[model samples]
Target: MKTFSAFAASKPIASLWDDAQAASMSEPELLLYRSNLLGSDLRITNFGGGNTSGKIDMPDPLTGQTAKVLWVKGSGGDLGSMKIDGFATLYMDKLQALKARYRGLAYEDEMVAMASHCTFNLNPRAASIDTALHAYIPKAHVDHMHPDAVIAIAASEHGEQLTRDIFQGELAWVPWQRPGFDLGVKLGDITRDHPNLKGLVLQNHGLFTWGNTSKECYENTVRVIAQANAWLAERSDVPAFGGAVRAPLDRQARLRVVERLVPSLRGKISGDGASGQRKQGHFDDRAEVLEFVCSQDLAPLAALGTSCPDHFLRTKIYPLVLAFDPERDNLDEVIDGLDGTLEQYREQYRAYYERCKRPNSPAMRDPNAVIYLIPGVGMLSFARDKTTARIASEFYINAINVMREAQRVDRYVGLPEQEAFDIEYWLLEEAKLQRMPKPKSLAGRIALVTGAAGGIGRATAERFLQEGACVLLADIDANALAQAEASLSERFGKDVVASAVTDVTNEVSVQASMAASLTHFGGLDLVVSNAGIASSAPVGDTSLELWNRNMDILATGYFLVARAAYRLLQEQGVGGSIVFVASKNGLVASAGAAAYCTAKAAEIHLARCLALEGAEHGIRVNVVNPDAVIRGSKIWDGKWKEERAATNKIATDDIEDFYRKRSMLKLSVLPEDIAEGVYFFASDLSAKSTGNILNVDAGNAGAFTR
Candidate 1:
């Protein structure tokens, strides 16, 4: 892999980052220059993978004098978008001194604590554990990454020989050693022995390249990767498996199996976290996963360790395989088969843990399989959140591709199971895991809210997030929905909020929203049917258009969302809550508001009917009747507000105060007040209450249920 690159040196660094510390290191900005370009390519290093380092002269804290310092990619920052501060600066001599102490330290020894004492600045985040390895290299710049093409060669059985053939003088090889102080010291030894080498490939791991200039280091990486790709491509005509007849994937049948399999699989693995608490996990069936897992050779190839040792951080060493046939079995048969498969998988995983775990290590990790391979179907990945599930899925798909390419050249081999476990459960990774905050009460639950762009919908969506539920905000107003999503995600987190443009009145649109809910967050637990409009008209004066619009959105929309969400709940075999945002106008007759009143009354009755039918399925359906809540409410906009003011002989601005005094408590009805009612029904606080009507209008006796 000795190909050359045409990369030109970047211009002088400018102050264009949120991190001021990073921008301040503008002179000799080689580290920042190289890191930016390297991080931009996902194929090179994705998410939080890879690190770059440089040697620079800076003032020393202890000596109050100028000294050479090692500035490396900080522990938690992403390289593609890293700023100057992303480079964790440490005095070279101090860091070099700590390396000797790490020689035989126990795996449980705190690497971060030892490195903390060497930091030139008191940055809170820990430095990358590979600091020593970078410092020991005499070159001006070093780049370490797990590029897929490089990993393909490292994972092959003939990887060591292939490295010798491709880049005879430019490259060197290092046998697989779990990354840490020991590995760092070994790398230093390799550098001294082979001073002329341009790069080093770590078997069953990744690649490392160094140069006197940042441009040279960057070019060496690209050229080496391109050579690996070209070499693999030259001999790529080989089939994935040796001459064996294989059956094709039944696409229709596989989809059926996926639909029937996800719910049962979710239930079996729900409570397998370290806390042993029943945390809900999301599922994903990517197109790439289907193309790979559906092949006959998947089970055998995937049974081995991950594409690289570091992948074990997301997808454990190996995946679980299950048998399924849509053509020969019913849902019950599928469930029984999964139960048996899951039990066997659990037994094998526990055995693997006992066999590999070192003494005095942290407790065994959750035994649940992150990736599942089903016969004749696609791969299914599960995790506590959508982002994690997607990460694992993407990694596995890449692994399959890498393994396939490696097999064409020679038999594919990866790090031994024990070594993979060591990396998977390493102390450095454990520290990162320990930092995760405690989960909320409804942390893993998924909620669907209609009319989420405004009024009660927005308020209820925010409330659900506060209680730890991932919410999907649905609304017909695409622009407003996008804004709501951005604001909510900023307040909460992007992973906890998703938005869908949904016309609740249309069956196709509503069904698509339901599918998105499952696709994004695994399952639906709560349905807040709050999307509707208010239309006022007496019997004779009401136009057909106004009447139909009210009925379609207020009445039919509620039915459609509830029906779609309820089916998913039943499939999951887990109880869920459905709350309808009905109106006090439904119970108390309001003249000239026939269409709005009638539609709301119908919505309340629909909730009662659903409650009766869904009771046996552990589904709860309830209603919250809010009266004249004018604040932040789109329902009270335009004609509704004008008409209210005209009726009471007051200014349009006085409409809010009029409704506030209309209630027996004489208190203003805010959107949050109504949201509280929605939350009560959605949470376990109302677990036993169904077919119930909650009056959220302070003291509206006229709208109260008898």
Candidate 2:
């Protein structure tokens, strides 16, 4: 095996397991540090795909006695950013004792219950299924990961022999066994027989390395994976671009194909909208998808299963191959062909499940293809949101790379279909589905928030996301727009949020922004017209330029956006909602705010007109009149705050307090408060309500309207 110690760039390695270094750290801190470090390495694992554990002694909260505990990575925790809560602390002896009685137990829910029973009552987080595999090793620290290099060899036809050759006698090999009590028991037996074993290679699964310290185990894993990569490099002569193409494709042409085909494919795989009308799935156009589509071996090579069967839950067994030619076919023609193609895929998927499913297996999963492989064009990932689509894309790209390398070393092979079915329908995964937090009020819905770079608009976007709605932020400020998009995407999955530069007053820009939303999310369900400038001026002094600017944005902007969004909703036959961010000044005139007041007033009245018109089509239009909500608001950013304070003869710092003290409740009106009112109208909670005016001003009696 090649050693990683000399390679500075291979991965950060610890030369030795220094007890003194470890003794200085707490158990949770040590585990968290190691878990984060492991998860940070993309080659080792991605997102929430791996598990790590340590056997330690801690005072049992229930008994106040020092007890041996197994701290394992908990289910539903992201290893890259985990904390103490991310681990489930279980009594190790109790887990070990279950082995004798686990002889004939089922590998699904029953196994899960037995494992859960081993966890301390205080640790409510569910332990990982692989906890038993770690526990069986009887080591201080154990690490299990599905690194791409390791999976390449592990999933090949000559995987076992190759593993033997690479590790020689340093690692023990376990034949393919579905991960559960049986697999754990087998591991225990192997460890007992070979007490000198440093690591294990589970065929078609992953790698496990154990050591006396977390550092040792982590280093061992890194070193072994490095060795696997070196071994493959020495043997495999696979060209990066596999196969010579019949026709070399242009990259720009391929991207055009994606732009044309993805929207159509998204529409084809959706649930029925209002009264059986068609809705569309979200599409994420990925560049890596082009690798397989442009490959010479696209046909046979793409037919291979995932990097491993464990990836089935994400990427599925196989991708859906669609034929597309940007130069030859129209998008409509491609979509017309898709109906029959998707039908075939569904039928085949159903049959595959029937052929491979065990007794009492869960119902077959939805037959929609997650990855669409276009021969001439690139690939597009389809899912309910962008994050899932991206994840599917990541797994498929890894699968393609792994299988390509495996074919170079030997013939590429995959886990048996039945084994894949079990993992796909594993009760643990099902239980995870069952345990999923109830869908938010607007889950699966989409919303577009204007002026989203800051303030009330930004809050509304966040609120929409919190309620399970995907939001596309539109702002004129390119820098702030990009920043907001990045921040929101980081918090939510990139799939759930997008951003576009929009000058709502400009017809072309407004139209393009709306079009981008449909392309990003497949459809639009809600529109929040909140973009405006705080151009406060008395009616006599208000210049024509200021009047037109305020009118174009506050009133005309709402009209342009609402008009476009209305057309989309009407075409999809799925009625949607529209909320205008009117101000208290719109209802009650304020001196030196004539331009602002008139524009907001016009905006509110326009919403009322749209509400009357939209009511016939089941679309709801409402207005939110909010008082000053200055925190983090672009409207409140820059000299606006200082300018407003100067007009009021008050210190800038006390401006928010002034607004707070003016309300009947003596509390400031918040952006979230306005968002709640918007949510009520956007959601089914106000299905029968239209032309409604929600005063979110902490009891602004003067702003009340009949």
Candidate 3:
């Protein structure tokens, strides 16, 4: 809501932005930095959704002393694709001075002061409005982005209240306001208040936090956003827009509209179009209908915009009106009516602010709604330029869709009016707004592994943790499950692992396990249906109980787990991945193992079916078949072991060699190797792959024998 003058100057900080991009820079260092930033930023936001900055000291030509400058990402640059040039430099001393005087000066004055101090050689590219905030950070590097999940929660009714409840004293909350000096000053003040605070949350705005180093900042951001995301997801009421007609707008038009509106509304926006069209269509006819459509539906449309509050600078709080009519088309009347609609919108916004503000807070200028459209007429968003407007419109549309759906569950609830005010005026959160930390690739991701007490399952859990994923380890054996958790915790730490005693054969147990996984990780992403009982019994001699048990775990268990994962993953909307751990018996027959073979074969087929069914929901399903993994397993200690020894007329020691030499490779396959295959299927590397049955049997099945 804070507006600054266009003529405001930006003062650069000393020792903040100057860094050598010389040829001598280590390739590994460069690659590491780039990859780290890219991965972290991308996870925080969608493609090109966030920004980053680094500070370095340069030798002052006259003083010979190091001066700091900030190298911030330029507008329109994606953190993922940002190069050294993508950053704009600002003097550190000037920036810090601006923060000191920020309380008394108008936002425009602050900007002018800062801009006047830019380096002579630096191209006169407009510094990001958030430059002052970035300068206030003590860290050498900073990254910022509007993560979709985090913003979705922050933009909702009671968002501020919920944030305060979840984060408690850990975070600073800033109210929704335009980004620039006013926001920076407020943030600076708050940061001073909470010296140890890891991050700041702008109510109805995006998140911001920094660290002494890039990795620290990135990790902190991931952890904080994850906390918010988990909290919100738990309380959210996202619904399935079942069999609804997809939006009718062309992709190009959608993007163009978003780009234009983003700067005007000052928010980030992205998502599918169905919701936007539906919301825009709600106000079919009006000269300023575009703005009305963009603005009036702020709560519902929160999802499509930059996830955080500060995005409003790019998109504006609302779009301008084109025209409005419930029934017919009248583009000319709508266009002519823009001025009046805008006036009305401004008046209403001021009234809303006045009604909501506390005695201590200063009132913000009422900006016109970000959207306006007339029925049967094209809609447009007004902003400083087309790109900003387009971004705003896109985000607005997306928010509308979310709002409409949320309405089905509960009338679109947004942050309480007081909470919104607090965030809009929060100084500490604004100060921390310099750069957001990058999110871990797997920060909010969830994984569930059956038979997790076994070596392969445990290994998979460990690997997932290393990649930043939260894991739910499920097993039928209570003692084994407990021990697995203890072992995994010792290796990977406690927060990364959770264990559930699950009997996959039981539908209720499967359901409970999945629910626990969701509760533990906040959402479901990957599932490893690896729990199965192996037995060696010939066809006629196999007990009915044995056959049923085998089928229950290997076949029916897979079906149940897949079904549970699919439901939760679909609810999440991000594509999910699932891997079924079958065995060599699935592909090749073996004597005295009818039930085992049948169960394995059914599991493989079940996975194929799930892959087909899950594709519609963006869930990938695959199978991994491993043969004779013998590391710390009861499979070599129980009845099956005795039976195998008797039937094969050999000691258990020789039995191991017997299975190993049966394969062409004559190599002993380890459980970790199978775990590797599971990882491949569970990650983005195999995004396009599904319905695949990968053989990890040491080439035992032979090469495509006809």
Candidate 4:
């Protein structure tokens, strides 16, 4: 195996402190800046895996006299992306007062509410359980982090000794204890008892460092973690992970395997996603990941589970290792046996829960594994949403680092089983879970929208995003796609939205979009086959090229898009919805526009055909026929508009108003109006309806279906 990273081997964590930058900042801004610098590097700490605090003087609300307050990272906030408001402020005096109310370890949970009462100025952000530890440290600034290098030593059997040896007695070591009121008091006593100690290591936990100022605290934390990394490097002479049991499969080969496995895996895990609350997937096969998954120690280490409290909370107690061998040609067989293998893992999890439940533990969460290790390919992590799924894979990478470094010096150790459970099902943690806002309507749904760079396609993509779906926007125009992607990504985060430059008329291009969807997110749940073209001409004047152009884009493009998405939807085995945006002409005859009318008619028929064939797989296909959508219509841009204006003997600029008057309801349809139709069909609101048509044509009598 490849050992630690080259940068990690060097072990120099240069201080990014700028005196010029720090000179103008107030204490709170400095704390935020210090935190951003620390979280910028994953080597310092994993995302959302650490807390930083600063004590500052602020005037009391009740009285004008100045008072010192503790400002710490709020619950569920990531250090990297948080704003000043993300910090929960509590009066230091009120925090100190809580110590008298502490009823010991058995009643530690009551302290969470007790701490909330200590809030300064009625700050809405909730304080985390780690609040007590920060409050009791007795320092102006404190930083508690779960760095891989530090955790490596923390998880090793000889960690306490290593802490003593490496720090030369400057840093101290505390045995494993869950964080709460008792642990906080103990930490306070330990620091007060040993005034010379700069910081300490908590077994199976993390490092806590303090200083007179925020800068000092930040530097001290980095210095200690750097020392640990260098010390481990000097001793790591042997190959990591028992020298790797098999070589990694090449990239293309691995993706091919992943494309096959992820769909089937997602389908089985989602259990049909009928609730619209399903799992989205993220996969990683980086060098470190490949080394670990292809290693001899993979099984034993994975079974022992993660060590840090933050790590195990995101990833479960153990990962389910798939029965796959990269060296053999047995992928087909392994895929076939996934049901049995997953069942065994589920049974093991059930047994663990049964063995560990206290009188009032929160009922078991989704029994399926969050992390799935495919020996040759890489790691697959799934969660209720895409960003979380990606975060799970990232956290596991940290676990891999911990295992690698611990093995280099001493045998790795995990937390005691019952202790792990206590953290997992803690009542405070359960309350946090309950407090989470309800998920959005399309939360966990993944969709691909063709012609999404502008107009109706763009509108549909935005609609999906607004309701909590990850969208892959596809358009043949690269520039337009880039612009659309930037706008949407800015509105909804970049993680939930991606784009692929695709010409849906090409079979290969359409298939590549599916692969792109799988690569960006796990698999496909919805397909909007909306790419189209419009034309109008007398039969004699309309060239065969014009006829074929309409046929190619409107008819063939829809077919290619449907066929590709159907494969992923079927493989995923989870139910899916496909909404095709045809046109009013699909059902209505028009003068001198036979080619355009026939092509749209064919598009609508295709959806009905797909609705028939897809029913067996629980895939619903429906159509939305939009007419005279002048605003933001890519079809109304040039030739089609002129041809239509001439056909109706109207002026070019008045086409929109003309259509408005033509509709029975006299409504001028906009792209956003058409999007509402797509949303209705794609969402579970239409879960029971299939092979249906919803028209956004402003009461066009010619196109009404009987």
Candidate 5:
């Protein structure tokens, strides 16, 4: 992992612009290049927080005449990853003409709709609310960014005066206003009124700089933010967060406490599935988070909330501070009180909503807090998916910097509840939410698949991810495990895929795998116990050690995985699904395979028992049985194939075809076929069915239940 630094006071934000790299790009390409360079550094901007725009002369399709067009980052586009298509293009003359129809601040939202009428070249990318800010600036290029160093000054009590003192009229100041056409018009007035102004700081919001070219605009932004850092560094005599009231626990001790904390909190924060939506979690125990959480002013500063609109919108207005004592190691005490504490936070959120609701405001959103803080441990953010949770936590880190710096230089201030409510529940924002595509079936679900490096196991993991589940792939083979992880990560995303080399038969390893689930993706939701082996031997030839090996892996491994998953599911209170992969031999007699058949039968029975025990807690346990699944199966890749073929008087290479022809349906079963069965049980489609056996054996009446 890369070292974590929260923008050191002594270190300045440097320019990353390369003139040589910019020489060959067209105007629009340069805009993309400039945006990427600025967005690459977290110190300059948080994810999806800033935007860049350039005015270019492109030929109008109608008359083949050159027209001036405004190209700005589209709504919901991230500068770091966006291509040229991510920009919204509009005719500049049409944008300015809308001013003639503007009624005033009360009609700002209506003006947003008119921007679509001005779309150029049939561009479908929607213009952001900040479009007008870029449009009215009157410069060839405009860069609006949310730099932590600059926002620290903007969030302070004396922000306006500080801007004057630091920039000496080079950068101007605008008071806090919800982003809209009115703010944009006001910015235009400021620049038009003062030609000497280099940029302007939006009070309690962000910074704005403009230039005649993209490179010049990019340089001005970096230079201004760097100068702000230099100014703050010179005044950094005050200790951060009032000089840290408590020290962090040792690494192992912290892990011990967090292992207990996450599952309990995850269940409570998920609202016990009352809302029918469970959240995925992300944990950050890095040094940057520890500095603030262990400080004397953690509570008050966190309560005051974050300043930037981008920060507060991603995170909620404020964070929920979990109660834990580092000195006494009272994690048990903390766990015991999570229920009441969580309920209290919900009540607080609801009350805030009630107080701030407008008649036309969008109905209250999920009332749970997005951020959670533990004094001596770290922070955890929960959202609809893993990436959202991770990004939310990052935005909060930006908030921490804003608050810590603002406090040292002057008193920090967050937006009033009403102002924050207005922006969050704005009609424009509501429309964007409605436009979002529906989430996938397993969107926020997290799963762990054992033997994941093998064919069936890897197939099941991919199926889960395709439905939007974050999966942890566990296996005993290190090399196979690494290969499977890379392949799955390439297909899906690395952010949602995690892997660990785990031996399921061992209690310690099973326990550690559960810990990995918590740390990697908050907590577990589905557990697939599919690890297996094959052996063929007559009753007399089967040794005690051979029978024990079969029983140890097939029976005990399933038991261990189920036992650990049950604890995690119960702790989460969100309930879960556990699917066990046994074999068709468990039901049908296979000659010379007494030990394998007996262990397989034991696995089936154990699942039944677990199903009975888990039902009351909302945990569902099911089983899938496959017959002669040789293709792509790791079991078939070993001597087991030759042993089984010789025992049954069949050629080793033709065993799969022989089994397929012997079946009632004469159809061959593959790993993907088995994966389908597992997916059915793991998803909500089978929510009402439990303790059920699904046979994926291509119709074997010999194994049919009577």
Candidate 6:
């Protein structure tokens, strides 16, 4: 349980605010400056899990009048490199009217109306739940962040008090409220009370601040967080937790637990013994337990938050505590203890709800505890979904670290049990749950694949089609494209595959292909920018033509395809995925192939930018960088490949072996291997993943430093 110094955390927040304020001086470039701030903040966070907004006093379209409007982050847009449409415009007067009303209208109704106001725009996007909060704030620019360090602190027991003590006169503290209009009204009230507050600390949530300028807002946030970090460091010593270790639970025992728990969970949990217990199904093997002993000699469990308050809906608050004793080594006892703890947790939860309930509010279901505490070890969170489980585990680990530090200062101060309950059953969040769009895993799915004449692109397209998708296959060689289409038609019928004979390098051709995809498939679900010309040349002597050619086809081509896909996907009102077929060169440069390496690297960045931009539209984008995908097609005929082979002074036949041996695992990198990675990116399994670069290089990239 390592706790960061309060100084360390608070310093960045101060610096960021200063920077943001400085950037705000240029009003004409406000949009650009704000976008840059958004991008920087997004990069600071793991993904663009945070958001930002700006208040603009604009003239009304219907009348020659000036009125304020809130331009807030849209639903699917990434904070990093956000575009104009990534923001939804809400009538400021209407928002103010809603705020004044205070409590009558439901949060869901407010959200729907706010979202509907964007109808004037050609490409309308959904408003984020925080739109109301942004609208209520007085500042011109608003920024919200989910920085890892800040979240680490907020997820702890003493988060609220620590935050208050750290920020002191400079910040305002708001209790945890579900993000929406209700939160907006609550925040509005706080703003009225603390008119001069520079930033806000939302307990168990994230941080938010606003400024007359974007720079002020950004810098203030940074400074405030830094103060908290410094306070933490001054108070306590952070202990190092031991590294990850797998549990010794056997497959049979794991199966029994899954069987017992799955029925109680909301979603169907497969992959247990009944689903033929694959390696992926074994939770114990997948789980990592990090052990930390309390250095302060305090009760370790009391220091942390009750797992993550946010994860309460998914995994119940507390875990089954297993104390380590010399006499209890039997595995059966441990399992029975776990079951008994769950039973007790359920009964206690019901009692707690009964005590806290309002007259009209319905009682919540007795939640199953998500965590398991091992006396000698720390804690473990079990979730039906891997993502939820992972977030819960991380949250627990972070909370433990913060709690340890907080105890040294003023004793652990967690949210009141009632406060936690309020958040778990917040009406605004409940409204969001009800309004959640229906799942359309691959609904209205359409895909376009470059180099789809053969190999990985072909295989990926086939997989997409199998998952109820329509595909457009593009290839430079007309005959090859036709032949590929014919073959695919025989296997998947004529309506499933559309052929486009165009070089991906040509902007017009790329645009045409994308258009054809939309026309034929009715919409686009994915874009697999797989077309690439490989080249092997040392950096200094690499030919300009060869370099330019590689860039034109691989890097620029990916950009063009992604750009077109963005338009079509947004038009269709369905989010999509973009999978770039960058080689492992994108991750780690190979010995030769300077031109190829540079292009691939650029492609990877392109995917990241697109992912950020596309998020607001429910679009997800990721890259699959494979090493030595050589199941089909000869690159020898391509000029870049021929020159590279000659430069390397080795026959093309030796290239595959050179890469295969470089990897720790002596597995050949096949098209199928790369295709699977592409499929994962394109599927609903990766709903929360964007700007991710998955390596399907058979441990090659990880094994080799460069």
Question: What lDDT score belongs to each candidate, Candidate 1 first?
Answer: 0.76, 0.76, 0.60, 0.89, 0.90, 0.61
Could you say which candidate leads in lDDT?
Answer: 5
- Candidate 6, which segments miss by more than 4 Å at Cα? 1-50, 64-67, 75-84, 103-123, 146-165, 174-186, 189-195, 203-206, 238-316, 319-366, 371-385, 427-431, 434-706
Q: Compared with the true structure, what per-residue lDDT tens digits does model 1 show for residues 1-706?
A: 1111111111221222334444555534767877887877766766677889878787766678988878898887888888887788877888788766663746425655688888876765568777767878777788998777778788889889989987886888888877776677778788878899988999878889987766677777767776776676666555553322333345555555555566556656763323243343444444435544555466677787675765767778888876554345555676777767777877888888889898856788778788887654667777766556777776776676567667777778967988877777776678778988876666667799999998899999999999888899999999999999999999997877888999998999998787667656666788999998876666898899999999999998998999988887887766789999999987887887899889999999999999999999889999999988888987687687886677567999888888888789999989999999999999888989999999998787778689
Which of 1 and 3 is ahead in TM-score?
1
Name the runs in model 1 displaced over 4 angstroms.
Answer: 1-29, 100-112, 241-260, 271-290, 325-336, 374-377, 465-468, 476-509, 539-552, 605-618, 651-653, 663-668, 684-693, 698-701, 704-706
662: Cα error in model 5, Å:
2.1
Q: Which has the better lDDT: candidate 2, or candidate 3?
A: 2
What lDDT tens digits, residue by residue, belong to model 3 across residues 1-706? 1111101111211121113542345422342354235434332654445556667676666578877867676554566655655566777776776555545534444564455566424546456656766666565766556654445545566656656677886776677665567666677678877788777766555677677665566566767766654554454343322212222233344333333222212211111211111011111212122232334343234423323443443344444433444233243354355446556767766776787766655546334555544222335453322233445555554444334433333344444444444445544334434344554445445689998987788888877877667688999889989998998888876655788899886788887787665333334668999887789877889999999988887888888888877876664455679999888888888789899988998988888888899898788999988887776555665777767766788887786787778777898778788988998899877889999978887786442223
**Model 5 Cα lDDT, one tens digit per residue, 261-359:** 888888876744444577788888777688888988899899998889999899989999988889887888989998788889889988988999999
TM-score of 2: 0.82
Which of the two, 1 or 6, has more lDDT? 1
Candidate 6 lDDT, 552-660, residue by residue in tens: 9988888888887787666444466788888777777667677888888899888888888888978898988877676574453455455645666767667667657
Count of backbone clashes, every candidate in sequence: 4, 2, 148, 0, 1, 35
Task: Name the 10 consecutive residues with the lowest summed lDDT in model 2.
Answer: 1-10
Per-residue accuracy of model 4 over 1-706 as CA lDDT, tens digit each: 4554533555378789898999999999999998888888888889997899999999999898999999999988888888999999999999999988887888999998898898999999899889988899888999988888889889999999888888999889999999988898889899999988889899988999989998999899989988887887777776788878888899998888887788877777885442235778888999889988888899999999999988889988889999888788588888899888878888898899999999999998777899999997899998999999998899999988888888887888988889999999998889888988999989888999999987999999999999999999999989999999999999999889999999988898888889888878888899998888888999989899999999999999999999889888988888799999999999998999999999999999999999999999999999999999889987798788999999999999999999999999989999999999999999989999899999899898888899
TM-score of each: 0.86, 0.82, 0.45, 0.97, 0.98, 0.50
For candidate 2, write residues 212-303 as lDDT tens digits.
87777778887887788777666544443365353424665555554445444554565462112223334433433454565666777666
Which ten-residue region of model 6 has the weakest summed lDDT? 273-282
Model 5, C-alpha of 53: deviation from truth (Å): 0.3
Full-model lDDT, candidate 3: 0.60
